[model samples]
Target: MFDYYNLEPVLMWIHSTMCGLMPEWLAFTIEGIAVGIFIMVMYAVLAIILIYMERKVCAAFQCRIGPDRVGGRGGLLQVPADVIKILTKEIISLKNSDKFLYALAPFLVIMASILTFSCLPWNKGGEILHMNIGIFFVLAASSIGVLGILLAGWSSNSKYTLIGAVRSGAMIISYELSIGLSVLTMVILCGTMDIQEIVAYQENGWNIFKGHLPALMAFVIYLIAGNAEANRAPFDLAEAEQELTAGYHTEYSGMHFGFFYLAEYLNLFITAGIAVTLFLGGWMPLHIAGLEGFNTIMDYIPGVIWFVGKTFFVVFLLMWIRWTFPRLRIDQVLILEWKYLMPLSLLVLVIMTVMKVFGLVF
Candidate 1:
């Protein structure tokens, strides 16, 4: 069994040590910069890993050998090579394009993703920002990345890009309702917005089991809405390659396009992480009502391990769905959200609220 450990205290110690060597304000600034850089590096590494995983996964589904030539085994270096290629490629500048917004768009998308990471509880007492309104902060912050997508599409001075951007804006706005309602259902049951508190509430049992049907419904709805929000296949109308020729980022190349790609994978991870945190009990170990010994054994495992394991499980589910499903048409995407998911989400929320009032949860 792995003993529990947390990185927060170690980071705080480093911050304090730096404070002793510099002015207080300077130390604070330096700490912020360091944290930001750490997040960026982490994001880059995870993107590389996810890209490689996605390629291998898709290739497996298609029964083809994937990237065997790039690295020693299974082409592990393929992502790094792709990154170097992108970095070295020439970024075309369109004369008719809005220069400033076009350049700023990718950064905006990346920034939104980075900001969302701050409030996520990686383990017990391992969050960067423990705000009372953590759930709301996450929902609000994650939505801002859509603005970057819109900007990229609009500033590209291409009809294809503009159409893709419009489709993305409409799809995201529609799906977010279902996403918000699903999250709200969890909040109603937990009666708290703090991410850590919600997780702690599930120490004895996961919310999915506690809330039963409503919780399961919310989880399903969240997964669907989240996939759409991340613009994954079936909901990737905004970047339908066959129709829009790579959609909103069609005009982008080199590192600019790389940023959009990185943001997409990061957003996928964020969506999966939120699902794990809310429905799967965050870092809490599996604890059955009568199995104390088993629960105790689970407790000995590090919380971070449980958290990451649950998160990646959800990520794998999303990937599986992506490879299995066909892309939905733009009209079908809106219809799924507005006609089906939205109404069902609202109904689930009501059911959960009533259950909470009557003390009916498990």
Candidate 2:
């Protein structure tokens, strides 16, 4: 019987087969190109899905029909149409803008998103680049987008963009601490930074149920900080449409603007992916103690399905928050981070560390 649960062996078989016919170096080169293409294709497909999902979700929340007249039922083709429109639209440039930086800014944001996306452990043996410090690598790559945002605003020479970029910088400086602390808390509990190992650590039970209160606290803190870092509402002060008029990318048009838009959604995916891996067990299926039959049935399902299902659930939670809550004022945003989230995160970190020290974590 073909076991869908483990794909690592299948991948190895394919690579071995290729090496038997082609030069070893050429085989590796082809494999790299293939993986690159897979990442790009997955990136575009997910972005399109998220764009449509958000519109429909927002419409539902507001009690309005969304994309009813676009293409198919429920505006199924609306996002694809928008994609075509962006591809064909002329990229408008400001005459006084720093040409080099302005052109480079959008690419920077998109590239950073792609780099972080590569770090996800998609499924069993499905990781593109599973490194020892995968979670930290993701954090570092995600931070690179901050530079892109700042450059987009500053290079454009627009006051509105500058203000938006400044707010983004302040927000990053504040929320990033909580995010790091929360991740560190998990690292202490899990005793490893490799995402795959973290998943393995949850083989008995997920960290949320295993570590109990502190793990739950870390999860909440990570979600809030992740939302803020991704600049999603209600933490979307960086591009408060009513006030800053599109924020850092105010002067961007067409596909340049599209890059920023897509990056926002993909960044959300990366955030949710990490959260799923660290707290929700990544590709590990649910396994309750003393439930042998139930566990066996769960094991029959593919790891990819588990990973994708858990990830989308988290994504929906983030999306729901975006449509339900109002955007925060800049001061409120800062106060929430510094006064509430940071302190809570620090406390959670300490508690988790104590749990690890005392062997209290299950």
Candidate 3:
């Protein structure tokens, strides 16, 4: 028999041993700090891999080879080289900019990006905090990034930055309504906001499959809303470079700009993680509920692979949309939210609620 719960104490003991010579409280503190650091490091590694994946995907779509000259076949080390160049570049501050906020903004956004990962249930018995309100916590942490963008724009003291900040604010707020409504619909059906519990609910079948028509429609609405929330095209009104220069961080230079850039990619992962947990079922293997052979095959795979595989699929779709579509104007973005997404989500929520009341879905 495979013993899973038995491994927890062993892992804890190893964690405790790694923080040796420290007081018990200090050991816990160190462990927490280590976990946080590990998350950051993982984000960086994933971002690098995603960058290469995105580059290759975009190249194929455009009929070109992306980054083929750096380190070996596909320039595997290209990301590190890019990082080095950014790290070595000059850091410049504008004469009239607010130094404090300008310097603080990038890290604030980066922190928000990392914080959202804390509540994500990556696998069975996995999560940093394991909170019941994990879904709400993730949403709250993600919203903090908009504030950082606002700070960066105002601190830069540039017209373009101000416009970018304003655009991001309006766009995020509009899209968030639909996103929240869709997520709440899931919470209503699952009867708990705990991510692990949500995952459990999807073990037999994904929510997108279980809830049938209503859940599928909500899933589509969620994806559209999430894309806008992540500032991805055709929803990238925030960084409309052709129109607003470099957008909110117009005056930021070197590593500061790099921070903003990295945070965008990190946000993509975080949003996809949320999507997996809510719709596709985080760490849950796929099964048609009547097929033992298929279920057995899925069970053979580790939980982490299922979780990461679904997340990357979502990310890949987002990249395809980014490369294939034209960017929408700010007004059109608002029209998309106020006119289409919000109404559809509201109607879908009502339909889902009615279906559950009638015992139409499990």
Candidate 4:
């Protein structure tokens, strides 16, 4: 039986096997290539699956048939077809556009997501980058996405795109504080910037349960802010279709637009991934305090399964919010962050800090 508790041994064993087959440097090069391909394929598959899932989910929410056109059996192939369509779409040339910046925007967004995913602990031994400042790194990489949006808008030289990009900047700037403060609440409780350590610390109990109401509040705030960061509906003032045509990437077509599309879905995964890692215990299976027998059974399931399941659950929650809630006015969106969420997150952080100092945590 695989040692389900820790798969690092298995990974190391695989590495040793690969090393035995080739020179050390060659093996390392191969592994590096493999990791890059793994990340790319993982996100590509996830983005495609998420796109299909979103269509089906939103269809159900709106009493529509969804993507039932492609394969005649619930349109199972529709998402991929859409991918091909976008991938093949011609890149429209814009008059008087910034050649350098306009071409550079999508790559910025895509690269940010790629960098953020490197530190995300997908499974027991799946994190490619293990920095002590994992939390800070993730936040920093995420912040780069806003610059991409702003540039996309400005480079396009269109009033609509500029407005959309500026709106995105304002929204992200406002929400990032709440997002950071919410994560900080857990950092206080856990006392580590390492995301993997945070998950391991939750082996006994997830932070959402351990820190009492403060953790719960932080989770709520994080969900809202993260959703905003992904530029999803309700909080999707950045890409308000009704107002900005196609928003920041309006001038982009072909794969440039596809890159933005892919980044959006990948951002959703990162948001949900962070929530699962920090609040819901990442890949750790659920266990009651004394249910030794039950815990044993739960551990039999793979950590990757637990992590992906928990992540998609949160993603589902995000999609639910997007389809159900109406988009907020731009001012209302800012108010929700500055006046309400920001203050509330600060309070949550303070309460969590006191709980830790007093040792009153669960």
Candidate 5:
């Protein structure tokens, strides 16, 4: 059954057939473009789904009906309608703005988000780019999106935008250290940077259990820093609605604003995906020692199903945190990073390193 869902073999067969019909380079380019388009469409669809899920989740917590009008029972069409409305709206531009940079910012943000997908292992043999430095590539690609935020703010020529950008820059710089350190802790435990290899290493059990306390601490810090990286509350000082009136994106309108909106949700998914890949075991199934029957039952389930389930579980956790906590002040956000998470993450990394040296990790 899992073999039927293995897309890599199918795609490879298609590529081979295409190569027979045309030049290998041309066939490969066409295949690549097709895959890229599929990913972009998936990203857009996922963003819509996340937006709807968030609204419903927030409404449930607040004792409200959420979206009841569109798409019948639950207003499932709300996001699609909103997308249409945003696309149809006129793009407003201010005089004396850096037109090129202002126009380029949103694409840059979306591009950075999309690029990270290449390194993400969707299932066994399903990564777009199987690079040796998979985890490092993800971190590097993700950090580039901040530049788009900065450009949007600076190019707008608004004081509010400038302030938001500065706050975001400072927040990212502070929190990114913790994120890196936490990820390094996992890398140290796994002894490999290849995302697939890390997942395979967890065939016996997840690192969250195998690596024990150090892995748990790294996961906690990762979640905190990941939320901050995505600019989600209570770390959303970069886009404090009451404070900056939309923050770095205050001057953006129509599709420009939509791009930022889509990028934010995509980044949320990326963070969750990383968490799932690194700590939760990616597509690996649950297996208990001396429980062959149960393990066999788990193996019957498809890898993609397990991967998506774990990723969305983490996504829901992030959403719960977002709605439960109020936005933090810029100073407090920085303090949480530099004063607490950063030092704690560093310590966890050192502990994991020592444990690895001593052969304490399972």
Candidate 6:
């Protein structure tokens, strides 16, 4: 079993060590501002890598070399170059746009994306906020991301912005039902909403495989709903560039537009992380029914490795879905959600609930 309250002792040890080595002011500063800055820096670095990788992966899928010129054969520095370009470019907010809300929306969205990480259990032993309701907290806080989108569109005072905002708002709202239902099914099977506890349930096998048919169905529904929730690919009706001419950020320029782009990718990462936590068994490794040696080797690998590897796989899958399919019309997107995903998720929830009640789960 995992220690639910282990971080307190670890923090005490760090506090004692810090007292022995440095002044109180220095310790406080390191723990307070420094830690927050470190997390944001890490977020920025990760975002940059994902941005470069997304472009390269998209190019490769379409039979082209992505960024050969930026930093050598792979164009690894393409993202940083893009960043410098944005920083040096003009800030062109529209005359009709609500300046305050237009400027504030991107940061709000990005902050919400960063905030979701607080409850993620990166390993068995550590999380910034290891709450019993970690899953609920993450899902609830992440929904706030849509608010920024709505603000950006409505505040921008453009028809394109309003349409994109409305589309995103509707899509997110519709898909969230399916996402929530899928998660409820998992919670039913695992019997806990604590992300660590859910991971512990998967010590034998991932929840996707544990509950068999019902879990499998939930997984499919989650993939569809999660993709829509993140506003990616076929469900990216919110900002269909060919149609909306840039969607909600149509009136945005320079760093403002950069913030929206950054938020989209960050939200993608967060969506993948949530999916890993729920069905793929965040940080928990695969375990066959009878292979103790294989299981032991899996256990030897650190939890963060398992968590991040599964997350990146999901992220790649999202990219693949985006590049391979044509965007759906907004009405068609909602219909898919209401007519297909939501029903399937509700049915799966019922099935899983029955399975759990009868003790038929793996």
Score each candidate by Cα lDDT: 0.90, 0.90, 0.86, 0.90, 0.90, 0.84
Q: Which RMSD values do the candidates have, in order?
A: 1.8, 1.5, 2.0, 1.5, 1.5, 2.6
Clashes of each: 0, 0, 0, 0, 0, 0
- Per-prediction TM-score, please? 0.95, 0.97, 0.95, 0.96, 0.97, 0.93
lDDT by residue (tens digit), candidate 5, 176-198? 89989999999999999999898
lDDT of 1 by residue, 1-362 (tens): 22256566777798789888999999988877887788778788989988998998889888987888887977988899999999999988888889999999999998888888777778877787789899999999988999999999999999999999999999999898999999999999899999989998887789999999999999999999999999999788899999999999999999999989998998998999899989999988888778879878888888888988998899899999999999999889888999999999999999999999999997
How far in Å is the alpha carbon of 263 misplaced in model 1? 0.5
**Global Cα lDDT for candidate 2:** 0.90
Candidate 4's TM-score reads 0.96
Clashes of 4: 0
| The 10-residue segment with the lowest total lDDT in model 1 | 1-10
Compared with the true structure, what per-residue lDDT tens digits does model 3 show for residues 48-83? 888888889889889998988899987999988998
lDDT of 5 at 120: 74
Query: RMSD, model 3, all Cα superposed?
Result: 2.0
Per-residue CA lDDT of model 2 for 196-286, tens digit only, reads 8898888898988988999999998899899999989998889999999999989998999999999999999888888999899998999
In the range 135-194, model 6's lDDT, one tens digit per residue, is: 888889888989999999999999999999999999998888998899899999998999
Residue 250: error of model 1 in Å? 0.2
Cα error of candidate 5 at position 157, Å: 0.8
Q: Candidate 1, TM-score vs. the true structure?
A: 0.95
Model 4: residue 300 alpha-carbon error in angstroms: 0.5
Residue pairs clashing, model 3: none
